[model samples]
Target: MADFTSRRTLVLRRFARNRFAVASLILLVLLFVGCYTLPAVLPYSYEDLDFTALLQPPSARHWLGTNALGQDLLAQILRGMQKSMLIGVCVAVISTGIAATVGSVSGYFGGWRDRVLMWLVDLLLVVPSFILIAIVTPRTKDSANIVMLVLLLAGFGWMVSSRMVRGMTMSLREREFIRAARYMGVSSRRIIVGHVVPNVASILIIDAALNVASAILAETGLSFLGFGIQPPDVSLGTLIANGTQSATTFPWVFLFPAGCWC
Candidate 1:
């Protein structure tokens, strides 16, 4: 218990001392809270239309102003945030899970498994992920398209994570405790679950955060191109896409969503 406490304190001290990580964590938390709370408390709905008030400039009543369709820009931003964050979190979790499992299995049990998994990883790494998503999304139903995109991104995203985990596992498998466990007749599964996974978790967490940012950017790019979260739903990317047409006339339409991205 004392050892665990000391380790945790050390980790916290390290994290606290890292200014970049601390800033990122603070921004992430603020965004997360705003995404969760603002939509629920706001008076306006994302889909609500008041054509009479269309294209109004920023005022006391409409802080960020009204869009081309007369929907509240503020409301749209809040709602879009929720959607963007959801996609980012989902992609990160799914991608990390797939990467960890495949990488661990392949790394622990070498020979053919390692060869095949590595080959597959290499094959995926060769292809452009965005191109793959664009091709695959159109063939699927609208609802399924998001899932397909997530899976496609996760499938490709796992390669780097797999390689990282595989490398770590190779090093970890030869550790004194691991060798002791093996000598004590511990099952491969037990050694992996009990030893390997815990050791690799810190790297997994950091990678996951980086992946979330990447996934958000990718989703935004897709939505900007009209391939991501489609109509009747709003995302930061979709909002930005919609705003582009009216931006010259009503700059707030684009600026509000762009502010959220910043």
Candidate 2:
């Protein structure tokens, strides 16, 4: 207990000492709260349209203003944010989880398993993910389904990290602790989960965080291309796509969601 307490204290001290990380964490928390909570308290719904107030700028009644459709921009932005945040977090977790699992297994098992997995990774890495998504999204057309979007983003995002994880696992699997576990006849699953995965976890943690940003950008790009999160539903990408025409005249429509998305 004492040892664990000291470790926890040490970690907290280290984290707190990192001014940038501390600031980033605080800002992230605030942004999340604003995205998820503020919309509920606001009087406007994204769908609620007021034809009389079409293209109105920010006002007391419509805080962020109204779109050409007269729908509340604030509500739309909040809704888009809700979806964007969900997609980012889900894709990051799914992709990183897959990379860690596949890489660990391929590396630890070696031979045929390693060859097959590496071959698959090389194939995927060679192909352009954006082009693949563009071609596939039309057939699937599950843009409205958040789960489908998450799966699609995760499928494209894991290959590079999986290769990295594989290298890390290859190095770690031959270490003394791993050799001891193998000699003690610990199950491959247990050793991989308990030993190999944890050693590479710091890399995975940072990778996952970066992947969150990547996932958001990917989703936004797809949506902007008229592929992701379909109409009446807004993602940051879809919001930007919808507002492009008005960018010159009604810059607020284009900028509001884009700003929140960034």
Candidate 3:
């Protein structure tokens, strides 16, 4: 416990020492708060139609203006952000967890187990994930599709990371403690969980952070391509998609979401 605390403190100190990382962390926190909370506080709804205000420029009355459907641009963008965040965070966690588990097992227990897992990883590497997602997502309904989107991304995202984990675990598994645990009749699962997992956790944590950004961008791209969140289900991607044709004439529609995407 003391060792874990010291490691955590060290990580915190390391993170704090990096000015850009600190600033980015603060900015992300603020952005998340604004995206998730401001919508409930505001009077506007993403789906609410204001027939009189179609494509109006930004004003105090409509902060980011209105879309062609007269939906509040600010509200739509916020809603999009909320969905995107959900997909990003969930996919990152799920992907990282799967990666850690798969990698640990494959590495620790070599032979057919390793062969099968590596084979699957290699197969996934060659697969066209986004196109498959595009082909399948539209068939699912909106709310369910969002969950499915997270699952699909996480499912596809873990392969490379898992292969990395397996390599790390291969080294860790041959350590004295691991061998000792095996000789002492400690369960393979327990040793992997208590020893192997923690040792590789730092890598997984970093990968998860990176995965969130990747997942968010993936969601944005898929949604923009009309395979993700879909219409009436506004996410930043959908908002950008809606604005594409009139991006020149009504730049606010496209630009607001694009800025948020950045």
Clashing pairs in 1: none
* Cα distance off (Å), candidate 1, residue 26: 4.7
What's the best-to-worst order under TM-score?
1, 3, 2
Taking the tens digit of each residue's C-alpha lDDT, what string does model 2 give over 1-262?
7745654565566566657656655765676688898988999888998999999999999988899899999999888878888788889999999999989999999999999999998998888888887667652235455677688789989999998999999999889989999999999998987778767776676677778889989888888888777776777888888889998899988988888777
Cα lDDT over the full model 2: 0.83
TM for every model, in the order presented, reads 0.88, 0.87, 0.87
lDDT of 2 at 190: 88
Residue 190 displacement (Å), model 2: 0.7
The residue ranges of model 2 lying beyond 4 angstroms of the native Cα positions read 1-29, 138-144
Residue clash pairs of candidate 3:
80-235
Q: In candidate 1, what are the lDDT values of residues 1-262, reduced to their tens digit?
A: 7756655665566566667767776877788788888877777888888788899998876788988888988998888788778778788899998888878888888899999999999999999989878766653226677777777767778789989999899889888999999999999998887678777766776777788888888888887787777777888888898888888888999988977776
Q: In model 3, how large is the Cα lDDT of residue 155?
A: 90
lDDT of each: 0.81, 0.83, 0.85
lDDT of 3 by residue, 1-262 (tens): 9957865665666566667656655765677788889988888887799999999999989998998988899999889898888788899999999999889999999999999999999999999988887787763346776788889999999999999999999999889989999999999998888778877776776777778889999999988887787765677887888899999999998899999899
**Distance from true location, Cα of 191 in model 2, Å:** 0.8
